[model samples]
Target chain A: MALTLMKGSEAIAEAAIRAGCRYFFGYPITPQTEIPEYMSERMPEIGGCFLQAESEVGAINMVYGAAGTGERVLTSSSSPGVSLKQEGISYIAGAKLPCVIMNVMRGGPGLGSIQAGQADYFQATKGGGHGDYHLVVFAPASVQEAIDIMSVAFDTADKYQCPVMIVADGMICQMMEPVELPEMKEYKVDLEKKPWAANGHGFSKKSGRSIINSMYINTEDLTVHNQNLQAIYREIEANEVRFEAYNMENAEIIVTAFGTVARIAKSAIDDLKEEGINVGLFRPITLWPFPYKELHDAAVAPGVKAVLDVELNAGQMLEDVKLAVNGDTKVDLLSRLGSQMPTPEEIKEKLLSMREVL
Target chain B: MKEVIVLIGNYGSGKTELALNFAFRAARQGKKVELLDLDMVNTYFRLTDRANLVKSHEIRLVSPNFVHSSVETLSLPAEVASAFALDWDTVIFDVGGDPAGATALGRYKEDFDALPEGSLTVLNVVNTRRPMAGTPAKLVRLMRDMGRPSRQAVSGFINNTNLARLARPEDLRYGYEVIREASIASGVPVLYTTGRPDLLETFLSEGHDPAFIGEPMAIETFMHRDWETFTKEGL
Candidate 1:
């Protein structure tokens, strides 16, 4: 495929389409509105369905209904909007329906600034909704990574019958870049393949009347269901911990970050390398699986001094870094909350200051 | 003599960035510049979002009234309607996206029509990387179609093809070729081959400087991926 210049949202929408997404239900939100806008333009041409839900709550439930049909369904929104969808997301997770959610995060405790943010790390990774469940969250740093991860995200959601969240910051959506869009998947939306689908009760005679609900009336049965969900999460954690270790060869410190911050820090790490500070970066690709072992190994390598967790939020991912480092090394945080972002020079300064402390 | 230039282009074609640069450059030259952001359709990453950046310079940004309100309602203010009657040396309308967005310009038809012939120029910004407007034919089609709803004939073309931070000197030459072909096809002059200062310097250093309309305007990118690099003050 030839590279074409496209905005991040458009690229991701196109990626979902190529990945066999035939239904896109979303609401208009800052940063991520273009995702639904693009889908609205393309979905009809490809015989797909694009519906702009009245609200994020309505959108996620629509995704829930669509996913239950065993079709690749996508719903995207920003911070506040994603928060609105949490209940539906929890319900979808509980029901074990496969679907993909893309959150182009913005700063917030409420309706925060329309700027890029990674504050949703905890909400996405630790399960924002009330349930003993974990969402497989992929945090991509660049527009290309975000686009590339969409197809895999849908597949991963389908494979585990779980909801996978592609949580990129607003920059990844607002930025323009040349992307090689994926080839369209040769996928037939076969309800028979999904024997468990409530697609008109498997589109024919079905298994036990095909009821899709999270309500397990019996307490013991619910316990077994919760256990099964936990087992799936464990399986995910074991097989799907994805992260990148940059310049860790004889690194005195690890500037661990995720998503857009990781990219900015990578530039800072390169600059720091030229300035004689043996610093590196540990960027987690999967926020939920957390890359604990790999991160711990990188942090505990010989001559490694300390670890610095940086983020767009006020150190939400810092907790995860602490858990990963697990006292194997000293851990600190450098962050700017809300809509503010630290430049690469600022990141370099923070790393240099950390070096001085070590 | 006050000059009013409206910029029209496809989505993601660097119209707002060019408008900001043109406004700032003219203001820096001591011109009383008034910028009318006719792009309410795009709520974020538009001129209204960069109110602080515009304030940092000499330019007066005529933002919509409801831009900063609790309601994200998009409505035209008196200032937008009275943009032409105002006393400003240079007025740049960062018009909305494509032909669809050009309808915003249609509302100011009388204001644009009353302007002296020599004082008005609607320049179509063509980013060749966007395949929808990549070729000479497509560029011409955009020039003709975008002019209809905009109520102004596109007098020129601004070749803004770029990979942003990844842009190089050759990319300029590539865009120049496509845009130059479109310019020839439509008899629309190539006003400026705009690029970031760094990329322009690289192009000059490589000794590929060619004769076109003046020196290519070196734009200060106000949005897109490197937004953090420029929006620090705005935030």
Candidate 2:
């Protein structure tokens, strides 16, 4: 396929279609609104379904209903809207259904500005909804990575029978860049093939009927279900940790960041390297199953002096980096709150100042 | 050469980016260029945000005074009038997207009309990928909407068919065909089909004349998307 320029939101929508996601339910919100807009136009043309739910809550519930039938479904919204969908998300998680949700984050506590921010790191990685379950969260730094992650997010969701979240900021949502789309995939749903799907096969002769529900009135039964969900999360943590290490072989400083901030950190690292300052970058692509071991290793690398965490918010992800680094080294933060993004020069200066103190 | 080129279109149709590309193109050819940032509808992705890059190319940037300030105002700055008074070889107005945005142009309708006939060209920049202007009828409606507010007739169309960096040759052809239909309906000519240099090559190989396609614009994706943050090297 030839390279084409695409906005982050539209690219993700198209990639989901190519990945065989035939059902989409979403409400409009800034930054991420393009996804729903794109799907609304493209889905009908592809013989698929696109519905603009009344609200975020309504949208997530629609996703839950669709996923119960073993269909590839998706929904997207920004921070505040994502919050509204939490109750439904919790229900979907409890039901052990599979679906993809995207939260193109914006600054917030309440009705935050429509600009990129990493403030939702805790909500996403720590599980926003009331739950004892975890979401496989993929934080992509580029549109291409967003496309690639979205393509597999559905498969991963179905594999674990859980919801997967793609965490991006408004910057990623609105920006346009060249991307080579993946080949279109053909996925046919065979109702009879999946005994667990609610495909209207009543409990009678050949196949057993499926009941999709999260309610377990009995305390003991609920405990068992929670335990099983924990086991799945543990397995995910052990196997799905993904992080990219740059110039880590011999570095005096290790910089930890993710998504858009990570790329800015990389440019800073490049400049620092030119100035003979040994700095490295560790970007965690999966936020939930954070690359704890990899980050710890990088933090304690030979001759490493300190660890710095950069973000678009005031030190939300910094806590995660601190937990990963333990007491192995000193941890610091460089951040710009709200919609502000730090430039490479700003990051480079911060790193240099940290080096002086070290 | 047109003394003034006015770019108007629906929101998110890549009008600001196209204006920047056109300004740089004229400056590279050693033409004295002045860029007017009349976009007040969108606070982000405006030409004023890239003042340093524009000045680096030796192009004078005229922007609304309220731009980049905490206060958002729709009033055109006095500098815009000063820009019109200048004797620059080429002056490009990066109008706000949409008809509401084009209302800013009404303030300068008199000055625009004073220019000799054919010296001013209003090009409706169309990105077929955008939902609002995807079809010829919708595009004709958009042109009409913008034209009514600017009080100037659209002389031609610029086919900016793209899916961002993922655009292919077929996308351009698809957009060109729609624009062709739109041109007939609106009685406007299709002045140029613009896109990234690489994708434009595919259009040419398919027998599109360079003159018809216009010079391929090397647009820098400065409006940072999430992908640009991590992938430093590639466009």
Q: Report how far residue A255 has shifted in candidate 2, in Å.
A: 1.1
Tens-digit lDDT track for model 2 on A100-163? 9999998787887778878888888887899797899999988889999987798888888899
Model 2: fnat (fraction of native contacts): 0.36
Rate residue A357 of model 1 by lDDT: 74
What is the per-residue lDDT of model 1 for residues A1-358, given as tens digits with 9 covering 90 to 100?
5667888888889889999999999999887888987888788878999999999999999999989888899999998999999999999999999999999998887988777888888899888999898899999888788888999898899889999999987778877777778888855656655667876644454556667899999999999999999999999999888898899998999999998888878878888789887888999999998899898899899999999898898889898889888898999888888767778888888878878878
Q: State the fnat of model 1.
A: 0.39
Which of the CAPRI classes, incorrect, acceptable, medium or high, describes model 1? acceptable
TM-score of each: 0.84, 0.79
Q: What TM-score does structure 1 among the candidates reach?
A: 0.84
| Tens digit per residue, CA lDDT, model 2, B1-235 | 4489999987667788888888887898989999999987666678887899899999999988777763466777688876668789889998988787899998788998888878998888888876567789889887887878899998788888877655677888888778878877777887877877777777767875443455455465554433544345322
Q: Alpha carbon lDDT of residue B232, candidate 2? A: 58
DockQ (0 to 1) for model 2: 0.29
Worst 10 residues of 1 chain B by lDDT: B226-235
